[model samples]
Target chain A: MIELAGVTKSFGANRVLAGVDLSVGRGRSLVVIGGSGTGKSVLLKCILGLEAPDAGRITVDGRDAATGDREAFLACFGMLFQGGALFDSLPVWQNVSFRLLRGALKRPRAEAREIAIEKLRRVGLSPDVADKVPAELSGGMQKRVGLARAIAADPQIIFFDEPTTGLDPIMSGVINDLIREIVSEMGATALTITHDMTSVRAIADEVAMLHGGVIRWTGPVAALDASGDPYVDQFIHGRAEGPIAALR
Target chain B: MRLPLSLLAALGAAVLSGLAAVGRVTLFALATFRHMLSPPFYGREFLVALGNVGWLSLPVVGLTAFFTGGALALQIYAGGARFDAQAVVPQIVALGMVRELGPVLVGLMIAARVTSSIAAEIATMKVTEQIDALVTLSTHPMKYLTVPRVLAGIVAVPLLVGLGDIIGIFGGFTVGVQSLGFNPSVYIRNTWDFLEPLDVISSLVKGLAFGFIATLMGCYAGMRSGRGAQGVGRATKASVEGASVLILAANFLLTGVFFSL
Candidate 1:
């Protein structure tokens, strides 16, 4: 399980996460939904220890997340960034197998490549694409490659940031299905941050809506529609004129 | 009263910001050095950086040194005629190339070439979130990106400067023998006999300092860059400017320390 209490972060004068408290149970999928610029990414980064919280405690599986050996703690977690941030210089297989090829997880180059190719296949990519660089892939392919990389080491925990952000509806559906299938098969603890309702409905076991740097509502995926909160209601229906003021 | 006060405020603000930028770069350089000494060093990355900064730079450094040396020989010949000291051409050229021009010119070229390239590549990586991806993949961006390049600069640029000094003096020799009415054997001997080991060493040291400054500025500017294409462009420009100014300043300091007498 992962937990955060009073997690706060700010960039210069602009406060992003303000005294936020949230958690995800082990072996469960939690999707944190929020609109643009609502600190969804910041919240996720804080959990990953990528951004230090001004005042907060984050614990994973009953241990302080930031207190342990960073490599060991991080080895258990897999993350897919919003932009499919693959290493531009490396081939697709190298990108997928990066962790395996270096540091404490170092393996033979050929073995790492073989595993990378296997993961690529798991993500619905052919072996032929393994030698190509990330630039050679399309938007959807890049995301899949990123997904393959996330699961390459068989991490026990996975975080997907905007998994279906820029794809077409068909591609989004395909990605959502892949995410769902992978999570189920691996039984990994999953935390996803996205504004996509379809993605939430498809992958989430529970849902948390973040707004104004706090969890506005939390419930099961099925109960999201009838949560009865005005902000939740305003958000789900996509109404412009609502309690949630639009950005200029 | 308002005008003067506002102008003062603006001046103060600029000064404060410049100080802050210096502080940031200093901290960044320290961090890079710290990571370089720690475990899990990236040898492949270091090798690649060396190749890019040292080997690939030979052609341009060689070409620039060659032309500068040729021009200096010509200028020395023309100016020395009035004083009847035209025979000092080889010695002057040797001293000029070995002690000052070789390091400075190579430093500037690195500022233009390597520093700009580092800033652009890293800024683009920052824009694209590749740095963040690196973090996720259990890597320090500094160790992977900055340390290797900076260390390479320290290692490779000295060699480049030494090569540049030799090539530059050779350029003078070529011009002196072919164009000027000078004895080839005496000209070569004058170039060789007049050069001190200290001069060559000082030139290499200047190269090291300039290389460090150029590369550190690039990485610092790039890592701190804002989002988008415009941000990357601005970072690249700032890197080159910072590198050029720092190289020149360092050149002066190194010269003073090396030749105080």
Candidate 2:
């Protein structure tokens, strides 16, 4: 479980997040839908402690996220970045097994490699792809590799940032399905941010619409269609004329 | 008067920002040292950095020292001819190369080669979100990336400077014997006798300082880089510019220190 209360962050004159309050229960997949530059990524970063919130508090399972051994706090979570963020210098297997190859979670080299291959396989990748670097992979394959890495350690919570951004519709569906399956199977709390309606329908157990640096609407995914909030209706419908300006 | 006031205000802002940057760099350097001394030491990363900063730098450092040594010898010989002091070429060449050129040239070459590469690589990593990913995976980016490269620079550049000093002296010897018509044994003897142990120590000390400054600037510029390709380019450029100027300034201060001490 995660909770954020009155979280506010500003970059100079630009206030990206202001008075944001959000929470996600354990083992639930919450997809935050918002237009581009809506501070969705910033919200995620604040939760992960990657970016400090100017004013507010965040807690995970009741412990203050700001005051703990950072490594220990981070150990319970995994993240798949928007760009895959695989280490360019490392092979695919090493990227997937990165957490296992170092730190307190370290495994023997051979065992780590085996686990990487297994995770890669679970993400619909072949063992042959393990030795190749991320650059060698196609965009969809790279996304799959990123997903494999996020779930490799069997983290209790996973954050997916734009998980299907650059992929084709079919690949997006595949990734959405994979994410849905993984979250369900691992019973992990999942927080994802995306504007993709297709992905939302496929993966979200609950939907939260973020706009103007606050949660405007939130309900079960089934209730998304009739949420009755103008922002949520405009966003889910992808209307050019709506509360969210088409031209920024 | 209003225009002059505006100009003064602008200058004042620049000075303040410059001071702020220096403060940030000082803190970054302290953190790097702290992480370096503490463990979960990354031996493999450190070893790879040693290879990159040390072994791979041999050719450029060698060539720069060799050519500069020869040029210094020629200039010294020609200058010495004015006062019928051509015989002093070996001693002067030895002093100039060992006391100044060897470490400075090698340091500059490293700034261009190793510093730029480190900055570009780290900046690209930051831009790509790999740095953020490192944090999510519970690896301290400073420990994983910065400490290894800085340690390598500190450990390796002194050796490169020492090698450059030797090759530079040999280059002078070759030119003196073959082209300047000096006896090889006499040239070697003069170079050896003219050099004090203090000169060698100062040269190595300069190497250590230059090395630390160059690599630290790279890591600092990189870790603070903004997003996208332009950010990477800016970081690379800033790293080289900062490293070069600092190395030169450090060389001057270090020279004064050595002489005074």
Chain B TM-score per candidate, please.
0.98, 0.98
Over the full model, what C-alpha lDDT does candidate 2 score relative to the true structure?
0.94
lDDT (10s digit) by residue, model 1, range B109-227 = 99999999999999999999899888888898999999999999999888989898989998999999999988999998888899888998899899999889888888988998889
lDDT of 2 by residue, B153-177 (tens): 9999999999999999888888999
Question: How would you encode candidate 1's per-residue C-alpha lDDT over A46-156 as one tens digit per residue?
Answer: 888889989889999888977978888888889888999998988999999999999888999999999999999999999999999999999999999999999999999
Taking the candidates in order, what DockQ does each have?
0.77, 0.93
> What TM-score would each prediction reach against the true structure?
0.97, 0.98
True contacts kept of 1: 0.67
TM-score for candidate 1, residues paired by index: 0.97
Which residue window of length 10 is worst by lDDT in model 2 chain B?
B169-178
For model 2, name the residue pairs that clash.
none
Model 2: per-residue lDDT, tens digit, A1-248? 79989999999999989888889999999999999998999999999999999999999999999998998899999898898999999999999999999998999999999999999999999999999999999999999999999998999999999999999999998999999999999999999999999999998999998888888988999999989898888888989987788986
